[model samples]
Target: MTEFADNVRQAAVAMRALFPATPMQRNAHLSAKYDADIWLKREDLSPVRSYKLRGAFNAMSKRIAENPDQQLFVCASAGNHAQGVAFVCNRLDRKGVIFMPVTTPQQKIDKTKVFGGEHIEVRLVGDYFDDCLRAAQEFCAAEGGQFLPPFDDPDVIEGQATVTMEILDQMPRVPDRIILPVGGGGLSAGARAYLNALNADVHLNFVEPKGGASLTAALEAREPVTLNKVDTFVDGAAVARIGANTFSVLSDTAPQDVLLATEDGVCTTILEMLNIEGIVLEPAGALSIKVLDDLRDEIRGQTVVCVSSGGNFDFERLPEVKERAQRYLGLKKYFILRLPQRPGALKDFLGMLGPDDDIARFEYLKKSARNFGSVLIGIETKSASNFERLFGLMEEAGFVFNDITDDETLVNFVI
Candidate 1:
């Protein structure tokens, strides 16, 4: 363990040649709100806009160290990991082949291309990451290329542990707790290794997207297990299966320490940081910060650190983020209304709305019936209870309505 700590520190020193340590900023807003000294480890500000570079760089460097003649590398990633590998490959002047899913955003593909220049070749393979992973592995084996496991390799883990070294060096005192966002678990695993070796009394909590809690599921089962389904909205942190190597280090974690942040709630946190603090956090990056609310009572008067994992968010998804946040906050909703085919019928329904209620969408879905029509309506309100009051008035006025805000099928198809 001591040797591992020493290695992590050495890795931190090596990282300086690439880029300086990412900032650990004390957030005044969060500190005041929680009555805790809150600091954010801004990995989002790294050269690749994520801590992924640390692991990739370390793994590649170690491989080069083992075989000086080795020059080829391969990886599979939809986002940050690809950029990390690309960045390292460019810096090391090595040839790289990155396999990505067909559905990966073009911005990421272009950015990876820009980072790697002529040294990296990107192949768009499957519709999902698993397919890309298989393809990359097959290609790497056939071409005699060293394959980089994003979070599962020991050298990568050692590289990621450098973040902990930087935190201890940057902080005035050891933090009371460290919160990390977990996906395939490399970052959390690496942090755990170095921090545990230091024998600090700090509490460590791992946050996972509620839709894809690979770590929590592993802990609950006492072994790593693949999730049957995963929500990819929090794309960077949504892993269907925790890496076996990472789970080995994290298996002893208490289930209670694995906090889950909802996809919608993550959108809210992203918006909060963006709007209030002007910090544009990717959904995966916001995971650690999003779950801070759950730890407020315990962390009071204590120092806390949240790892902002990445800032590679696409502005094209901004409207979707805003929509999810609004839905989660109960400020927006959609419903189907049965309206009579008569003049002033729409006016009467509009008249029933409270002063704070605003119609965001109103369209007749169908007018096939002779007596009434199906109207798709979207409403925005100042508060959640406004909908309740509006519904009561709607009921009294003999208006038939179906609240389809929470209906997945209807929302996907109509709203």
Candidate 2:
């Protein structure tokens, strides 16, 4: 075995001492839909409901073995990584200090606490992740404790490689393609390294949220670059910058292998997996699956594996997820219509509705002129083509309207 493969195998063996390998199940629903043999490496079933715990455990275990006198561990994270570190602290009976942004959801903080119990102390340090990370690093330096990075460390990368080791062992043969979600790139880098060492014939596809395409941006720049802004809707994988160490391993990857998934697009996949397969996936977890539509032609009849990285979804976000899915599917839209100030104006507009059209919202914006008034309307329809027909009717009837469904600025203020 190559050195990387040996390290991955060692990580896998070390993992078994803590918890059983996560399932690599063939997803019948996705396989039939995509016309391919689709498998999900279910990292969502890990003890921390994420593959992150593997890296944290592997890194800490190796460190402890080398120096048994080391007693303190420190890490900073907003979600999965925090839980992973906390879990390892509890498992190893070691004291750990975790720094998280004050803006972190209560659900995540609670889960981290549950996993760490008395072994970990969570410090709400700053409003932004970067600030919390700084605080954690300072604390680690002051206390002379080992700092456990979420993805930048080599040991953590080696730990994450264990997932690929399990995938190969569970499958009958090497998969034709493997899809991975990239955050700071720990899992992607590790898995890619191990798989490349084991079988050069396998195709690797990397998925990143469009709003936070750090990996894609880095690949284009030929180095890791920090994004000016990032949409944190997919919090689990929304990283503004890729880790320097993780990027080194992924730098040689071809640009064509990277795919970007929009937040709304990912929401659609999340809802589909929940409704159709009874699977609950966080936005990050759904990243790989969301890109299946884009890979339909290439993966047909071929064996493919998509890693469902985490299920750390907050139930409170369900409503927002549903809203995003509807918007992406074209089942919902918002518009500002100019209505004539005639007695039968409302009735004339209602007559244009298709059989499947439903008015979800309606409001009068203002009387821009004596002859007309601006109406804010939200419509839901059965099919996307329905909008074209509706628009034609509006044009023929001399009704003026503006579609604000995708206007982020306007929707944020008025919708």
Report, for all candidates in order, the number of backbone clashes.
0, 0
Candidate 2 regions exceeding 4 Å error are none
Alpha-carbon local distance difference test for all models: 0.93, 0.93
Each prediction's TM-score against the native?
A: 0.98, 0.97
Candidate with maximal TM-score: 1
- For model 1, the local distance difference test gives 0.93
lDDT of 2 at 195: 76
Please list all clashing residue pairs in model 2, or write none if there are none. Answer: none
RMSD (Å) of each candidate, 1 decimal? 1.0, 1.3
Error of 2 at 342 (Å): 3.0
Instruction: Tell me the tens digit of each residue's lDDT in model 2 across 127-181.
Output: 9999999999999989999999999899999999888788888998888888989
